[model samples]
Target: MIDGAAKDVAQILGHIPALRRYARLLAGDAAAADDLVQDTLERACAKWSMWRPGTDLRAWLMTLMHNIFLNRVRDWRHDDGHAALEDAPEPAHEPMAHAPEMLDLHRALDRLTPALRSALLLVTVEEYTYAEAAEILQVPIGTIMSRLHRARETVRVLMEGPTDAQRTHPLHLVKR
Candidate 1:
């Protein structure tokens, strides 16, 4: 039988691609995303004892990555005379595709705020349930729902480019 540590490594390795995708969404740059994933994996290995085998391993790993990202954001913000965006390398341009829908979705995703983007990607791209996303993000379920709703609306508006109906018939909430 494989030891617990080996099993844990295998499980973590299986989820690295997903973690990298989530990190890319959160970081907005490919290199930064890779760094985030590396940090997350390192932390996971270092703190392997804390992880319980039977529970949701993916969720636990995501939580670690999210926390690490938040800390990085905090530190980046606090640094004097440090401009993170300025330091970031420019992304290489790729050839245009025939499919506009995919391009539009990517552009809309780029426009979203980090929090909204993370929430949307976790639920939509990663196919995580609302509860799982909430747990990974360390937020309440209601907050996750609210973020998802707003994120969806925002992405829709972005992809659709402010239709006339949006101006004439704004969305309204009706209390039940």
Candidate 2:
């Protein structure tokens, strides 16, 4: 039993980096992301027995993190004294080593709705399959596809300006 528990701890520890990455992208604030990861680890440790031995632990952990994040968002909405999560200023940090385009992509990601951003990050950044991402997000596969589509399009527009079709389309133009 001790050996089994030790193995479980090791496995859970192995997934922490992935959790931190996902949390950072999802929260868009390093401090908030670290808090989210810590919360997730605490919950996982408390519920370790409930996890099946052969299951995909990373997906399970991500599901817990996602649920926790959603709950926080819901709570934040009800709390009148707190500033909006999105309105919180970006945390100070060293500049990223990536190019200007990567910075733009990050900014575009920050602008996405939480649901859309979650879907995009799970699929693109974390490299989860559509089915896996759907399971993690507790949504249907079709819903994941739709969210990914919208998220990608929004990011593209934000990064590259509108496409030619968008520029030429009467419906996309401002009416004076």
Query: How do the predictions measure up, each by TM-score?
Result: 0.82, 0.88
The sequence of per-residue lDDT tens digits that candidate 1 reaches over residues 52-92 is: 87899999999999899889978878989785777966665
Candidate 1 clashes between residue pairs 3 or more apart in a chain or in different chains: none
lDDT of 1: 0.87
Error of 2 at 112 (Å): 0.6
lDDT of 2 at 176: 100
Give Cα-based local distance difference scores for all models: 0.87, 0.93
* Per-residue error (Å), model 1, residue 147: 0.1
Segments of candidate 1 deviating more than 4 angstroms: 84-89, 95-100, 165-176
RMSD of each: 3.3, 3.8
